[model samples]
Target chain A: MTFANAGTLGALPGRRDELVAHLTRPSTALAEVGCLLYEVGVSEEHPDTVFVVELWTSAEAHRASLELPEVQESIAAARPLLSGEFGGFRFDVVGSPLRGGA
Target chain B: MTFANAGTLGALPGRRDELVAHLTRPSTALAEVGCLLYEVGVSEEHPDTVFVVELWTSAEAHRASLELPEVQESIAAARPLLSGEFGGFRFDVVGSPLRGGA
Candidate 1:
């Protein structure tokens, strides 16, 4: 089953674009670590929020990715721009019409 | 840009799988309306919650889908099983390495 991590991160005041840029930076190592999808989004209603959705080969793979140096560095770089407000949830993907039973 | 809608729906008690089944019921009409990805998931922490993530070609495409008979029918069928508790957010996808700038 594909493990999914979906959530929102709040950027300090008008720093949302900066946070998003850091998030979208190419991290080729993610694919080797079993990340199938990594998406970043911004909402008009929540100007300061950066939404992220990720799909991994398994929950273990998702967890392991956090330990990768590239991942760790990215997190460190993004920490300063964050407002400490976060919301998220995790799940095992049951199905996806496009992906056929993710 | 891809428009993303990601959220959770609470099921009435143990009816989560049922709700997930309905949600994953292969709505081919969705693709016709510019739906790119539609995923359903369940979390171990929240047994009664069904998480959904969707990617549409545009926000307008997503709204148009809500009026489709197939979509309306599915919503009506699933309504009775819902707990009326929903948590979701919508955003315009600015970038995705896998999809190349979604």
Candidate 2:
């Protein structure tokens, strides 16, 4: 019963590359921390939007990572390129039927 | 450039109430720790699956909240009632165009 915090992001036109690059930038310090995963890429149905996925040990860990200078800097760098609204919800993984092959 | 960590979850049948109740249960300590928001409901299109949305001060805050005994116990309680898979993505809020009323 792991809790997962998740959300989707909308990117500005022609700025997908910039967004991805900013997210995937070198992060030696972030890696040293307990950040489980941080991936950013373009959406298949909506190319103008980039999908970001991250897995953290806990909500606290996720919040702490945000306070880091590196994370803040990366976000600032990626800001200008966004166009549309970006928001998402967070939920705990109560169960995963896919584990049984659904 | 606020980074929003978000995701969606699927709940078990006839258990939406249970899921929501589990998430919204009274907590004296959790509320004191700066866990921003935790909400659970059903999907409009997919009623069989419950929808969960949370807004935390930061990813770390969301993760740390999970470490609390209350969160853990709630998760364990809700586990058996779930049916399908639950997962989501996290993204940085580069910009929100809706601010202009879209």
DockQ of each: 0.57, 0.05
Q: What would the DockQ be for model 2? A: 0.05
Query: Which digits, one per residue and each the tens of the lDDT, describe model 1 over residues A4-96?
Result: 888999999999999988888877788898999899999888999999988899999999999999889889999999999999888999997
lDDT of 2 by residue, B9-101 (tens): 566767766665666566655545554444444444566566543445555666687798877887888888777677655443333211210
Q: List where candidate 2 sits over 4 angstroms from the true fold.
A: A1-3, A94-102, B1-14, B17-102
Off by over 4 Å in 1: A99-102, B99-102
- Per-residue accuracy of model 2 over A1-102 as CA lDDT, tens digit each: 233444556777777767766666657655455555554544445667776545455566767778889879767877898775786554334432212210
Q: For this target, which candidate reaches the highest DockQ against the unseen true structure?
A: 1
Q: Give the TM-score of candidate 1.
A: 0.95
lDDT of 2 at A31: 48
TM-score of chain A, predicted model 1, versus the true chain A, to 2 decimals = 0.93
TM-score, one value per model: 0.95, 0.50
Residue A84 displacement in candidate 2 (angstroms) = 5.1
Interface RMSD of 1: 2.5
Candidate 1 structure quality by residue, lDDT tens digits, B21-102 = 8888866789999998888999888999999988899999999999999889889999999999999888899997565443
Worst 10 residues of 1 chain A by lDDT: A93-102
